[model samples]
Target chain A: MKTYIAKRLLGAIPTLIFISMIVFVVIQLPPGDIVTSPLDRMQSQGVELSSEAIQNLRAQYNLDQPLPLQYLSWITNFVTGDMGYSYLFNRPVNELVGERIGYTLLITLSALLFTWAVAIPAGVYSAVRQYSLGDYALTTVMLVGLATPSFLLALIVMYFGYEWFGISIGGLFSPEYRDAPWSLARAGDFLSHLWIPMVVVGLGGTASTMRILRANLLDELNKPYVITARAKGVKPLKLLVKYPLRIAINPFISTIGFLLPTLISGEAIVSIVLNLPTTGPALVQALINQDMYLAGSFLMLLTILTIVGMLISDLLLAWADPRIRYE
Target chain B: MSELKSQDAIESDNILQVRNLAVEFHTETGRTKALQGVSFDVPRGQVTAIIGESGSGKSVTASAIMRLIQPPGRVTAGSIDFAPSGSEPYDVLALVDKDSRLEQLRGDHISMVFQEPMTALAPVYTVGNQVAEAILCHREVSKKVAWDEAANMLQRVGIDDLQRRMQQYPFEFSGGMRQRVVIAMALVCQPDLLICDEPTTALDVTIQAEILTLIRQLKGELNNSVLFITHDIGVVAQLADHVVVMQGGRVLEAGTVRQVLKQPMHPYSKGLMAAIPGLAPKGQRLATVASVVGATDITTAYPLTRLADGRQISLSPSQLKAFGHE
Candidate 1:
């Protein structure tokens, strides 16, 4: 098992390197350089730097170099822990990400947890009671959840939240606790305000998971083994959970490979509406202004997370099912 | 003619009695009567084999005994009276609303081995766990005791290396070995009535022989009555003391194995006998089942094709003499 995991991790290095190249090219795809974009924003703010100084800034940031050479330098520096500057925020790219990373990680994890908790049981119920009134009701609700725009939902929720309860409808904490240091009270306040974004983001994912699980489980329930188990006199509930369910959950587990990486920058628009200080907005801003190192680093992290998530889920699947063989 | 019967005549000394059992399948096309007034009996501590071709209600009879028939197919009429050892006879069909009572009987007092033995064992669970689960489901025993019995059952089924083999998954075992595991699972609870639903049909000849021998040995040791469901007349001959032959959801003839095989009364039963390959003479074309039975409107699919020369496809007198037919 250790050897299999080691081989998997080793294999992932090349995959991440390939993804980094794609992330670099794609981040650079939009027309406009870091210097020109920041220069345009600065002019809009009624503060302008001369064109010579602009050219000087490009030279300083190595924007004057060829793309390949620049990528090479950026990658080397990144490997050595020197994530470059972001002219958009006038701060170090690493610092900008660092400030919001904690909140982003917390919310995304919570949202994912909520999604699985709600979706798996709902799917099982829907499948077991397929075509029943309850199944149809759940199907309609899931369709609505999937089709609704999350940003619009977030806006409506935020408006109702403030109007109804006088609770602060945006951000991770109340005004006084926003800048507070680590404390149980502050943690409690954070949680109190955390659920809004979690729900708004998790709702669509919950619907998607329900659909996948319901379909997979329905297919599994019809297999001969289910009948065999039933004939063994296994009770209805235990039979459903143990025999077919164990196999049905494989597809859902494989989804974990793609799910974790998306968490880093998912819900960008929803986060914007809720005014949550998360890296979702930062990654979007970095891509827009061509903040190459910041955007590349975030994208690289997403790629690494994808590789890591796939490895973890593969190991989990192997553990859950003895049929899977790494060798 | 001595086996002339209705529901009540089948009750005495029988471990299982199915009386006018009717199952209908309701689908979008329409309701089709799958089992029409099907009645049979399994005598105590003996193998009573139900033989029929596909869709002849052979499997439905097994399912009805265990009450495992699913939706769209329901037993609309019947009283399956099960007189399990040490218990009074009760209507098996009446336990439909009493799932707890049925659960107590199924896999505990009555267990079954299905045709697809590889698919019968749950893929993810260990062979030992799958077997032990049957014991634990109906008995109030510790995990260790249940597993010990499970291992013993496997040993009785002739599987060697109990410890390591118990830990292995279904895919790790061969088809014959898997069937043994399936049998071990069914018998671990020491059920009063064992249902074999074409258990050897999926196996190759040598493996099938091995499985048949194993079942005979195990059934004698446990002293359990078996409702052996199969289409193979050869298999019925090997194991059954009595036999019931069915066609088109109705019983054509049922009596002792000697009476049914040697003196088959119905045209369908006679056709089934003639269809067995080795009984026909060499260098003479064997009659297709449709021609042998004089295929009825309901059984048209049995006709392989029509031959212009009926005399060319006739069975020889010597083979007919061996089969105890005129």
Candidate 2:
């Protein structure tokens, strides 16, 4: 097991490097550097703009360097404290991400935990009591949840919040603790409003996960081993948990690899609709502005998480399933 | 047209009495009457083999005894009066779903071993943990004690190196060995009635003989009644004290093994008996155990005779089914 983990870790190095390059190239794909848009804006607004100033701006951002050198420089500076300085925010790229990454983690992680905790039991119940009233109701509700896009749900929810409560349902707080530092009151305020975005982001995931689990568990419940366990006098709940659920949750656990990048990036459209201050919005802005290091670093973070998440899930599967031997 | 034995024929010491056991499978296609009015007695400390071909509802009958039949397949009508030796008789069919009484009855008063060892045990768990879990479910013992008892049971089943073998998963063991572990688990609780559902049909001949011998030995040691379900006449010959021949979910004839094997009264029973190779069709298989095993392998490997064999030139679909190919 240790060797297997070590081998996986070693193999991920090249994949991370490869992903890093793709993120860099893709972020760099749009013609012109960060100066292009600003220069255009300044020119169109009938303001005086200088060629030497443009040359200095280009030199400052290393736009004149070769692509590989630029990549190396960006990566190196990123390894240090620089991160190619975000001109839009007038802050370092790392600091910008660090500020918003907390909210991003909080929203996604909470939603993830909530989704699994609810999905598994709901799915198990649906399968165990298949074709019953409760099963049908849950199936119908989850189908609706799956079919409606999260942004639309968020919009409807926001509208309902405004109409019913006479208050805006946007952002992480009630505007009083917008820039407040860590404190019990601020934390409470944030949490009081946490559920909306979490629900909006999590509904689709929860619905899909529940359906998968239900199908997997349904297939496993018919397996001969379940009958053997039943023959052993194992009660319904214990038997389901012990025999079929253990095998059924394989696909769910394997989804960890897919979740890290997705959740960390945040749901872009949903975040926009809910007006949550998460890194998801910043990612798109950074790429569009050609904030090379900022965008590349964000991608790098996702890339690292994705590969590491895969490793963790693979190890977990190897541990849980005796049949899946890593060696 | 010989019929199933009447209730009067059931010995007083019978461990389980099943009557009018009718199972139905409700599917999208339609409802299938898998078993209808299947009556039998599992005499105490004796092996009663219910023999039939595939889809003969023999397995359905065994599962119905434990009420282990899954959804889509249910025991729609039946009364299995289980009167374990030294215990009061109870109407098994009266127990509702998830009833504690039924739970206690399983693994304590009754247990079951299945046909294929390949899928009989959960793959994730160690054999020892599984057996120990079975013990723990019914017994009021500590984990240590349950595990120790599991090890002892494995040893009892002729498995040497019990400590090592118990820690291993099902995939690590051969089919016969896994079956041994399964038997060990079933007998570990020392249930009065143990259902063996085609237990040796999936095994090779030598392993089959060994497993049969082991089952008999364990049955002797445990002194529990066994309901052996199988299709092989040779297997029934070696293990059964009483024989019940079934076709199309109904028992055609049943009696003491001696009486039924010597003089089958029903025409279907006679045909089944004739299929035993040396009694009739020789080279076509079923004469010897090896021939029977080979024949089953052939049918399993090739459903249609794409083989340019002259023997199958005149074969019809019904004739093919008579050979049990479909």
Best by TM-score: 1
All candidates: interface RMSD? 1.2, 0.8
Compared with the true structure, what per-residue lDDT tens digits does model 1 show for residues B1-326?
02223346336588887777889999999999898777667889999999988988899888878888888788899788888777777888887555676996788888889899778777888988888888878888999998999999889888899899999888989999999998988888888899999999899999999999988998989899998999888889989998888777876567789877887655677788888888888888886667786756234222111123110111234433454544
Candidate 1 lDDT at A197 equals: 89
What DockQ score does model 2 reach against the true complex?
0.68
True contacts recovered per prediction: 0.68, 0.88
Q: Give, for candidate 1 chain A, the lowest lDDT window spanning 10 residues.
A: A260-269
Off by over 4 Å in 2: A47-53, A264-266, A325-327, B1-11, B281-326
Per-residue lDDT over B196-295 for candidate 2, one digit per residue giving the tens place of the 0 to 100 score: 9989989999999999999998889788888999888887888899887776687655677876788754445655776676567455545443333333
Assess each model's interface with DockQ, reporting 2 decimals per model: 0.60, 0.68
What would the per-residue lDDT of candidate 2 be over residues A1-327, giving only the tens digit for each residue?
778878888999888777778888898888988889998999899987688888888988788888999888877776676666788788887788788878887888788887888888999999888889999999889889889988899999999999999889899998889988879999899898999888887787888899899999989988988888988988888888888988999987789888766665446677787888887888878888877667777778767767877888998888888788623
On DockQ, the leading prediction is 2
Task: Please estimate how well model 1 matches the true structure, expressed as its whole-model Cα lDDT.
Answer: 0.80
What TM-score, computed on C-alpha atoms, does each candidate reach?
0.92, 0.89
**What is the lDDT of every predicted structure here?**
0.80, 0.80
